[model samples]
Target: MATTLKNRSWRLSAAALLLSFSAQAQAPEAAATPAGMSGQEMLFWVLVSLLGVLVLALVLTGILIVVQLRPQLRKVYEMPTVRPSWSGKVLGLFVGDPVLLQGRVRDEIMSGHDYDGIHEFDNDLPPWWKMGFYGTIAFAAVYLFYFHVADAGQLSQAEYETEMKQAALLVSVGSDDPNKLTDFQPLTAAADIGAGKSLFATNCAPCHGAAAEGKVGPNLTDEYWLHGGEVNHVYKTVKFGVQGKGMVAWKGKLSSKQILQVSSYILTLQGSKPANAKEPQGEKDPTATKIAMR
Candidate 1:
């Protein structure tokens, strides 16, 4: 009886230690992020710790199995007729009392009048099932305390807001209002023009031909102002397109710097005069000619 108690105590201790390690692994620590560890590094460390814990649990389980089976094997060696049942002596440790392990023993049947020729047995529920039920209750209480009572974890809405704030930090939001125009000059850098050429090919080249020769749109090469040909004027025109004209507004679609880039790029095509160019639609801008001469 003392040996049985000692073995059971050892099993309980191992379980407690396993639970402690699992709880430590699951609990969130706020200090790691400020310490400059990247998310991937933290996850890698967490996975390594979990793997170590798993290996330790397996070792503890093997130790417990050996401890429980040793005495039973010794008893079998001592007497052949009094040999211990493998199911009762070995597997019974996990399922509870030896008699209860393989369901109702004959002695457990209630000594009462049978109903419909069938006798009922008064048997306790399996220990493993009861333990699992109790575990679920304990887990529910802890989860409720951690998330609601103690407020240790963020709720769904709080997590979403945190993610949005983090995303905002990574992006730069320019306060330049599209309605409020700027007197910005067209970019003259070769790199800026090169980027503008790529952007134009991808976005603007479909409507305004590959060479800005105007397929469905007005010719961009001529000294005519469909919207205004000066850099700032062209910037405004691109930023906010003409209403009732097939020109689509690019305010939200393109960034302010990108609009300026494409506008400056368009201005560079003023004198190319490519073939199959559409007729000039708007009046000539003398201001644009004056700016161009300078």
Candidate 2:
């Protein structure tokens, strides 16, 4: 019985020792988890290693090429003692091979024609500069087609007209921005003038005449003025009309933008001829935006 009990006790001790060893192995495996890598990290390292290997192979190939050509290069050409940078080697790609004359390559690119015994080689334009010139030509052709023929893009004049329309539209829609309120910007576009022409014929033509040659009011086509001939002054005169001279204020009846438009149109009438035109009224101002009454 004692012998059997002792064997059972020894077996129990061996089992406990095995459990301890198993626990230690399990703990180390759990601790290693924080130091583990994800699939992306593994892929990144693999790609980097492959790139490094490829770069190494290319370097080795370049070294081999240099070694193979060294003997020929030493025999035929005079190479610089100092080594060139990798960037210089990259620039050499565009520059082509070095000359056998041991001088700058530009010195060899002389014109073929000679003057006063001065010999000249062929004049070849740089590929980069020629490419830029060709690119500008292509751009000009595309611009002509797109803006003039196809009408796919806007020209400077077209863009100006479009912006003016948008601005006037905003004003018509009752926008109350201070910039728009005090806006003295005048548009000389034909469409803008046409809109103003309609307003003028309906309102001011009784006094100013259809051709702005003046009836009861002063001649607008002449280089003479009642108030002033500057753009902003013209706009102001139209806005708050000269009440004492039988010119009624149209501010309440017309929009500020409409008044400005008519003012710009009136400026365009300078130097125009009309049948039975009224005589000029006011003194000429030097600062007037005039195109001379010719």
Candidate 3:
């Protein structure tokens, strides 16, 4: 009776140990899941992969359809051939092949002409050249049809004026009035003056002279001033200008800052004497403040 009881207990213990081992094996699998990636994540990746494969399959199928259908469609719509003369074939080889060159066709014929011992073969121009010539004719016809006959895009003088007025409204331009002059203030920094000097050399040197000694205009180097000598005044004069005096208003032509830079550059020219200074014009007031243009 006791042996029977011990055997039953051993069997129960063995079964419990086997179940614990199974649970332990399953616990590792549960713990192995990454922080961000769960079973749902794995399923999502698998679904994405399947979708990519499906898309690739669809693209391949489309390419196959196009490859199979193109030649059959072309065969169905084959164009009739226009035969050329024997002389035309010979000329066609020298220019490009007629089939290779679009729309060029040969129609004229030329036979061999023999004069004494000399023999020459006369041939017509390639069909390609003829077609090109004909294309120009067609283009002219179309252009004339659209421009003159249809008059779809034609603009009347009033319409053109209206368009010009609208376009002019979009742009900000300085006043055209000679009496209302624009002003440019000089930049004080040496770096700014240096940049302005370079700019003047490139842009203003032709008319104003390289050293700012007036060639077509007044001298900037000398204290004897024609227009106002103040920094802001000079800036304004440089930007706008004396209307009848040949100095054009550079307001729209140059940016506000660029004009200021040029003004600053002109200021640096003071005291540096150039060879031929234009005789100073305008009254020199004794109380005229010496303003730094740079």
Candidate 4:
């Protein structure tokens, strides 16, 4: 009976061993991955994100370093306090220490004179001014060395001439076209006749009646044209007075367009009856045109 039990136990052990081998054979193999990241892509992404954060942190640290260092760099370039020499020291003792001398001198100079104990010193320029003057001389010497002798940042005569020529080219007047004339032609619209009327009333009303009837000057309302009736010609005559004629040219005072508008307004006066119309003086207009001045 004991022998039989041992055989059964051995059979059970062999069966268990076979079952373990089968399980091992059936298991899936792990896939090969670059950088040993297989099956842990999430962890890999987390590590990559951390690296980017670290790079950004480094950049911010660099910027902060630059900002903190700037003021220290500026201090490096600032002027240092100057120490007085033997001569300056001696002068300071007699004139109240150099540091305090400025205030003392200023007080003495500004203090009013008294009748019994009268005393006053003329206001003098501060020591800072003298120092500044010396500094200016030093700077001028340095500038002369750099710009004249060393030729550093200096403009040659040829370069200066070229620059001047370019500037002249930009603004030089090239032609006498009417469009180029900037001084004349202040008004150009037909509606500006009202403005012309005002001007005529103020200036021409004394010679020619307010109604433009002949008075000291020839009748303007009549068709008898003294000078050319054209607008341009009338503008010219108004701008430049006719030689030996009473009309004087108003070129410099009134703009060309203003003169033109006034001329047009005058044409509108043709044949209009005024309160007092002078008898016809010059040759009548061949056109026999009639216009109402209203």
How close is every model to the real structure, measured as TM-score? Answer: 0.38, 0.36, 0.35, 0.34
Instruction: Look at candidate 2 and give me any clashing residue pairs.
Output: 110-121, 111-120, 111-121, 112-120, 112-121
Better model by lDDT, 2 or 3?
Answer: 2
Q: Across residues 1-294, which tens digit of lDDT does each residue of candidate 4 receive?
A: 445545554555555555555654675556345575655895577457656655555555545444555554334423243224444443343333554235234445435565576666766565667678999999999999988899887468868998977876676363222223223333335477787887788777888889999788888887676765555445556776676878776767787666766776777777678877998876765643433434
Q: Please give the distance, in angstroms, between residue 123's alpha carbon in candidate 2 and its true position after superposition.
A: 99
Per-residue lDDT of 244 in model 1: 89
Best by TM-score: 1
Cα lDDT of model 1 by residue, 1-294, tens digit: 657856675776677567867787687765456477888998798678777766776667666766766677555544644334554445444433354344434446687857998878777676557768999999999999999999999999999999988877765454344444568887878777777788889988898899988887777888998777888888877777878888877888999899888888888887788998888879988757322311
Off by over 4 Å in 3: 1-185, 285-294
Score candidate 3 by TM-score against the native: 0.35
| lDDT tens digits, residue span 175-196, model 2 | 2332333446666777778777
Per-residue lDDT of model 3, residues 126-204, tens digit only: 5578878999999999888887799865557758999978877776565443344455445778777877888889878
Candidate 4 all-Cα RMSD:
25.8
Runs in model 2 lying further than 4 Å from the true structure: 1-183, 290-294
Q: How many residue pairs clash per model?
A: 0, 5, 6, 7
* Full-model lDDT, candidate 2: 0.67
Compute the lDDT of residue 17 as modeled in candidate 1: 66
* CA lDDT scores, all candidates in order: 0.73, 0.67, 0.65, 0.62
Could you tell me how far off, in angstroms, the CA of residue 116 lies in candidate 3 after the best superposition?
99
